[model samples]
Target: MGRAGPAGAAQESSLRLACVWEEPPAMGTCFGLPCDVDSRDEDSSQTLFFHPSTYGSKIRLYESCQVAERIDSFHDGIIFTSRPIHLHERVTLKILKKEGPWHGGLRVGFTSMDPLEIDASLLPPFACPNLVLQGRTWAAVLPDVCGEEDTVLTFWVDHRGRVFFGRQQGVQDILLLKGVPVRAPLWAIVDVYGHTKAVQLLDPTRLCGDAGEPAPPLSPFQSDVLHAPACREFHGRPQGCTEPCVICFSHETSALLHPCGHASFCYCCAQKVFRRSGLCPLCRGQIQNISQARLGT
Candidate 1:
C-alpha cells in the first residue's frame, strides 16, 4: 500500500522500504494503546494504506515518518492493516520533517493486546524505535543489546501508563520489571547459557494458545532473580565451586568464613543445604561467596 502526498501526487521518489514489515490495524478499530492517526486532509477520507493480504490485515501507520513527532507524545500514530504480513514485505510511505536533518527519524510505540502474548521475533529489531509494550508495563533494551553488561533496562508499568525503571547494583539488581503479570503466552524467553545469549519466541499453542494456562503475576522474589547478573558458575557444585567460607571436611578441625559472611561447608553438604534452605545450613546465613575451600590442617 502507499500514502498519497499533497496535490494527489504519490511521491515514489522519496519512498524508502522499511527493513521489517509491520501488520496494520483495521479501519475504525480501537488500538487499545495511546496513539493517534492523522488524516491527509481536514476530512478523514484518507485511510493509511497497506496491502491487506501480505502485511496482515492489521497495520500501524506512523502519523509522520519523522521520529520526533511521536517522541514523548502521550499518543502515537499508527496505521493498522487487516492482514497477516511476514518479514521482508516491501511498501512505500512518506515521512514529514521539521525542515532540518537535526530532528528527523522514525519512532513507533507498541502495546500488546495481551502482554503475555508477545513474540520476541515480532519485537522491532534492537533499538529501531522506543517501544512501550504490555500496557507500558515492561521495557527492555533493543534486541541488539541482548548480552551486553548493563545494557538491559527493566522497568514496571503502572495502570496509569507511568513506567518506573529498576535500580542497578544491589541484592535486588533484577532487570525484569516487577508487578507485571505474565498473561498467557510467554513472548520472550532469554537464555544466558555458557557465553551464549539467545532469545526465543514461544509458540502460542504451547504457551498462551488453547492448551496454555494463563500466566500468573511475577512474585517479588522471582523478579529479583530474573534481573540478577548471569551466574557463570554453578553456585554449589563440586567443581569450580567458589564459596570462600566453605568448610572442607578434609581439614579435620577448621571451619572457613566466606568474605560474604556465609558459613563454610563441604561440597556435598553445601549441595544438600542449597537444596533444602538455599542458605547456609550451619549459620542460617544467605550464601553469597561461591569459591572453593582451603584445607586448614
Candidate 2:
C-alpha cells in the first residue's frame, strides 16, 4: 500500500501488539479477555434496582431508583428491574407503605419479555390476569403475611423457571407459581396493587455477611449451588449415625422443613433459624415446622 489511512495504521498497530504479547499492555488480563473485568465484577456484586424508564405511568421512582411508589392509583404500580436478573438470583424488596382500604397486597413475578421493549402506557394497571393473561408473564398476589409494612420479601426464579417468594424476617420463600415459560431473559415485575402502595429495593450484600460479625446467614443462592445434592440426603437419617446440625455442629440434625422437605437442622438450631430467617440452611426451603427426626429418617 502506498499510504495507510489513520484507521488502517491503528488496526495494524493493534495487530502488532497482539502478536508481540499474549496479553495486552494491561497487567492482569490476556488479549482475548475483557479489559472491563473489574467493571463486571462490580456489576456482579451490585444489587438490582428499579428500572428508571421501564415502568407504569402511575409508578414514581425515588431514592436514586432504589424505591418505587404508586402515586395516584394502586393499579398502575407496575415496575421492573434495572436489568435482567440471572437465574436463581434472589431479589429482595421491603414494603414501605400499604393501603389498608384496598383489597389486595403486592403482586410479583417474572416476565420473559423485556419491559424496555414494551411501552409503559401499554402496560396494564394490574400485573395479574392483565399482563399475566397476555402470556409470557406470571404473577401471584402475596399473602397478607408477606404484605405488612416494613416487611422484607425475597423472590427468585429457579432453574425450572418456577417462581418462589419469601419474607426475610419470616419463613423461606414458598412456591408462588410454577412453569414460567423461558423464552427470553426474565425481568422482575412488581405491581404495587391493592394493599401495597410503595416498595424499596434492598442490597443483597447485606445478606451475604455483616461487618465484624459471625458468618452471615447462608445465602439461599449460594447454598443452592453448593449443597443441592447433599440436601437430598437429609430426607432420611443415616442408620446408627448422629450427624450434627450444619449450623451449630453440636446438636444432632432433627428439624424438617416442609414442602421442599429438606431436614438439615437440629430442633433447637432450627428454631433459631426460623426466628431469624425461617429458611433451611441447606436448601433454603421455608421452615414450616420442626419435627423430631424420625429414627428411621
Candidate 3:
C-alpha cells in the first residue's frame, strides 16, 4: 500500500469528519452522536460535543456533487490558525459569509482539542472549564448563530486565564467568559451543522498584547485569500495548471477559461470550447469569457 499525499490526506480526513452532527445526541453523555443544540445540557456550564469532527473538517467542501448541492440542511466549520498562539496574545478569527445569516448560522467558540481528535461517532461538545461559545446575539440556552451579519470575532486569553470575545465593532468585547485556565492550545470551532450558511475563516492573526497597551481596532488586510493562495500547491506556484487539464487531457492549459475560470485546456483547445459549451471545466460555472493568463509580463 502507498502512503497518502497531502491532497489524499485532506480528502480522507474530510470524509471522516463530514458527518459529526447528523443526529441529535442524548443528554448526559453522547460519545458518538450528533451534538447539536439538543445535545447541550441545560445544567452544564461548559461546551460539549461527543461526536466531534476533525480540525478543519468541512462537509460541502468534500462531499460528492449530489450531496453537496442538496446540502441545504446545515453546515459546520472547525479550523485553527496555521500556527499556534501564546498566552496574553490577542487572536482574531474572522467569519466571512458567502450567503449570510440566511438560515441557521454558526455556533462559534474555542475548544481545547480538534473535533476529530476523539474517536466518538456521537462525539459531544467539550468545554474547557469556563469556555464561552458565542453566536450572533448571545450565549447559553439557545445556540443559534444567525443573529446578525457578524463577519469578525476576536479571542484572547489574559494573563489570568480569562477569555474575551468580541466582534468587528472593535477591541472592546461584546461578551466575556472568565475563570477558564488557558491550559493547552485552543482551536476555533464553528457549528453551522444543519444550515445553508456558507462560512469561511479568513485571516486568523494575532492582533496584539492585552496587558498595559490597549489593542487597536480590527482593520482589513491589504490583500486576502481571494487574491492569493495561502499556501502554494506545487512547484512554487498556486493550485493552477499544475496537473492535466480535465477537458483535452492533452497539454497543460496555456489559457485560463476565465470568469468561469480554470486552465483546463491549451489556447488551441479553448478556441471553440466556450462556443460549444458555456460551462467551466473545473467549477462548472457559466463562462462569461475566456481570458489568457499572463506570465512574466
Candidate 4:
C-alpha cells in the first residue's frame, strides 16, 4: 500500500470521509459535454490514490463525471479522457457516487503500455481471463468491470481485436468483455476501490471480544470472490442466462438508463427511449434520467 511517485505522499485515515481529496477540478465542458482536453498533469500515485472528500456538493449530479485530483505516477494510474480514443472507438465511464464511509476501491480501464507497469490496484482477482460476474459487476473481455452502485463502464474495440464491455451491476446490462485486445497506446483507467479500517483497530471484540458488539458492515466490493482459477498449466482458451429486452422481445426488463448507463429497459421501452431521442440508444449518451431496478425477491 505504498507506491508513491508523482509527489503524492498523503495517507492517513483508516477511515474518515465526508470529503477531502483535493486538487483536480477545473473541469467544465464535461457534464456540459463537448470539450476535448488540455491542462496536463498525470500521475496515479503509482497505482491507486484517490481520496476525494473536501466536503463535496457543488450540487453534483454529473456535470460530466470527471473525477481526478491527481495521478500520473509517472503515467500509469492514467486518468481523464474527454477525447482521443480511436481504434474501435466507443467510450463511456460514469459511477459518480454510491456506498460511502470508505471501503474505497479502484481498477478502471484502458492501458497499452507506454509506461503502464501494470499494477491494476494489486491485481490478483483471478489473474485476468476475460470476466464472469455482472451482478456485483466484474466481467471483462479480460479487464474486469466492477461496481458498488452508481455504475457505467462501456468500451469498444471491434474490427477484430475484440474488446467490448458494458457495465452496471445489480440490475443488468452485463455484457462483460467480448473480444479483449485493442491494446495500443490507449490510456485512461480510473481505479478507486474501498478500504479504511481502523476504528480503534476494530476493538478485538471489546477487550477480547463481544460487549454489545456491532461495528461490522462496510459493504461495497461485491462479486463475492473466486477470481483467477484457470491457471493455464501451459495452455489457454476456456470459459449468461436470463436476459432479454433491449427494448421488447416480449417483456422481462426492469428499467435503468439513468445517466447514460443502460440497464436495458422494459417499462414500455423506457418510455420508448424518451419518446425517441433523449439519446443513449446505445452510445448516443445523454439521458439525464430513466431508472427503475429491483426485482430479485
Candidate 5:
C-alpha cells in the first residue's frame, strides 16, 4: 500500500495485536537444536524465514475477538438480559454479611431466599399442615396415630421444618375430645411452627361482638397453689418430701404448681418431684398443668 489512512492503520494494528495474542504455538518446533551452519541447518533456516503460512490462520484471531466481545457484552447485561425470577421458583439465599452483636446478629440481607412464606403448597406431603383449633394453640393433622380418631391431631413442626407428632399427654393435648365437636374455620390456621399450639377459635357471627368477660378470679386455695413454695429448700431438701403434696415449698423460694389442680411445690423440690410423678405428688390428684409458682413479695 502506498499510504494507509488513519482508519485502515488502526484496523491493521488491532489485527496484529489479536493475531499475537490468539495464535497457537507452531508444531514440530525443536528446543536446543544446534545451529552449526551445516547444509541441513541452512535448509531449516530458509524454511523458517520463507514459511509465511506457518503463521497459521489470522481469521481465527478475529473469531476469538468476536467471541470475547460477545461474552463481555453478555456479562454487562448488554447482549443477553436476565429475566426476573418468579416467587414460585424455589430459591435459596446465603448470608455473606451480617450486622449487630454476636448474641443477637441482625441479618441485613440474605444471598438467597431470606424470609420464606408459610403456605399450604410449600409444606411437605407428609407434613401435618398447621391448623388453629382453639384459643392461641395451633393444631396439625397428626402424622402418626395420636389416639382412636385421626381427624384432628397434634403435630409439631420445628424451626428447621422437621415434622413430629405424638400424644404427649401432659406435653400435648388432643385437638378434639371424645364427645366434643370442634367448629373451627379452615382459614383460622395461622402459625405452622411448633412454639404455641393454642388456636384462636373464632365465630364468624361474633366477628364484631364485644370483648368477653375476663376469666374468673382464683380462690385463696387456688391462689396459694398458684404461688406455691419452691421445689428445693434453702438447704437443698426436696419440697414434695416423699409424697406429691400440692402445697409443698422448696427452700429456694421457687414454687412449683402441679399441672392438674391446686398442688404446689418449691422450685427445687418441684423439679425433682415432677420428674417422677407429674400428678399431685401427695394427694394422687391429677395434675392439669405445671408452672413456676410466684410468691407475693
Candidate 6:
C-alpha cells in the first residue's frame, strides 16, 4: 500500500475534524432506560483498529489495522475492536469488497469478553452458532443485500444490552441480537465471512447523516494470503505428484472458488477453467472471480 505524504496526512486530519461538531443521532430506549449515552470525549481521544493479537488465523489486518480481510478457506475469520466502545457509541464500517460462491453476508454485534484476555487459537471459525453458542458473544448475519461492496453499516449496543445495526443512510436501525450481558465493557466484533471479503472501520466521528463522501478505495498494493502456509507446489517440483493443483498439477494451488470455497487451481489454470467451463471442477459451482483469497493486510 502507498504511504501518504505530508500533504495527504494533513488532508486526512482536516477530514477527521470536519465532523467533530456533528452530533450522533439519539438512540432508542431499552427497558425504560435511556440508551443514548455520550462518551465521545473519552472514545474519540484514542485511535480505533483491530486488535493485533486476538484475531482468527485466517484474518489479516491492514490500513494501520483499521481494515480486516479473510483469506485461505474463508472460515476462521473473526475480529474485535482494539478498545471497548462506550454505551451508544456508534461503530461504523464500510464493506470494501465482496466475492461469492458463498451465501450470507457480514455479521456484526458486540461481545463482553476483553480481547486481550482471550486466546486467539481458541477462537471459533464462525460467529453464528460457533461463537454465539459460547455465551457473552452476540452477532447476526446481515441481509444478503448488505453483502454488496461499499455498503456502509453502523451498529451499537444500547444501555439495556440490546444490539442494533443498520445502514448509515438514515437513523433507521434493526435490532440484531439482544440479551447481551453488558455488565462488563463491550467490544465490537465482526465476522468477515462468506460473500463479504473485506471491511474497513470508519471513524466514530463520521456519523450516518454527516458524511456524504463515498468510502475511500484501498491501497492497490494491499496483499492477500496473510499468514498462509507456503505452497509446496509453488516452490518446487511436486514430490511424487502429491497435492498438486487439482487442475494442471504442474504448479501450486492458487485461485479459490466461491460458493464451493475450494482452492485447487493456479492462476493460469484458473483462467483456463474460467474460460472453458466457468465452473468449479470439484463441485461444479458457478465461478465468480479468480484470485487467491485474502483481504486488507
Candidate 3 lDDT for residue 230: 20
A best-first ranking of the candidates according to their TM-score comes to: 6, 2, 3, 4, 1, 5
The candidate scoring highest on TM-score is 6
lDDT of each: 0.26, 0.62, 0.35, 0.32, 0.23, 0.63
Which model, 4 or 5, shows the larger lDDT? 4
TM-score of each: 0.19, 0.55, 0.37, 0.21, 0.16, 0.59
Model 1 CA lDDT for position 80: 21
- How many clashing residue pairs are found in candidate 5? 43
Q: How does residue 62 of candidate 1 score in lDDT?
A: 18
Query: Considering TM-score, which of the candidate structures 1 and 5 is the better prediction for this target?
Result: 1
Task: Tell me how far the alpha carbon of residue 42 in candidate 1 is from the true structure, in angstroms, after superposition.
Answer: 43
- Judge candidate 1 against the unseen true structure and give its global Cα lDDT, from 0 to 1: 0.26
Candidate 6 runs further than 4 Å off: 1-44, 206-211, 222-297
Model 5 regions more than 4 Å off: 1-253, 256-259
**lDDT of model number 3:** 0.35
Candidate 6 C-alpha lDDT tens digits along 153-265? 88888878777888855567887666665545678999887678888889856533455554456645444332322322222233443243533334665566665455645
Clashes of each: 42, 3, 27, 37, 43, 3
lDDT of 5 by residue, 210-229 (tens): 53222233346543432233
Please give, for residues 205-242, the per-residue lDDT of candidate 2 as tens digits: 56444422222332566424332332433346567766
Angstrom error of the Cα, residue 220, model 3: value is 20
lDDT of 1 by residue, 166-244 (tens): 2222224222222332221111111111111211111122233352332333357643433333223222335433332
lDDT of 4 by residue, 138-234 (tens): 1222221244333445555554544455553334343323332332234333333331101011111222224323233324431111121112222
TM-score, predicted candidate 3 vs. hidden true structure: 0.37
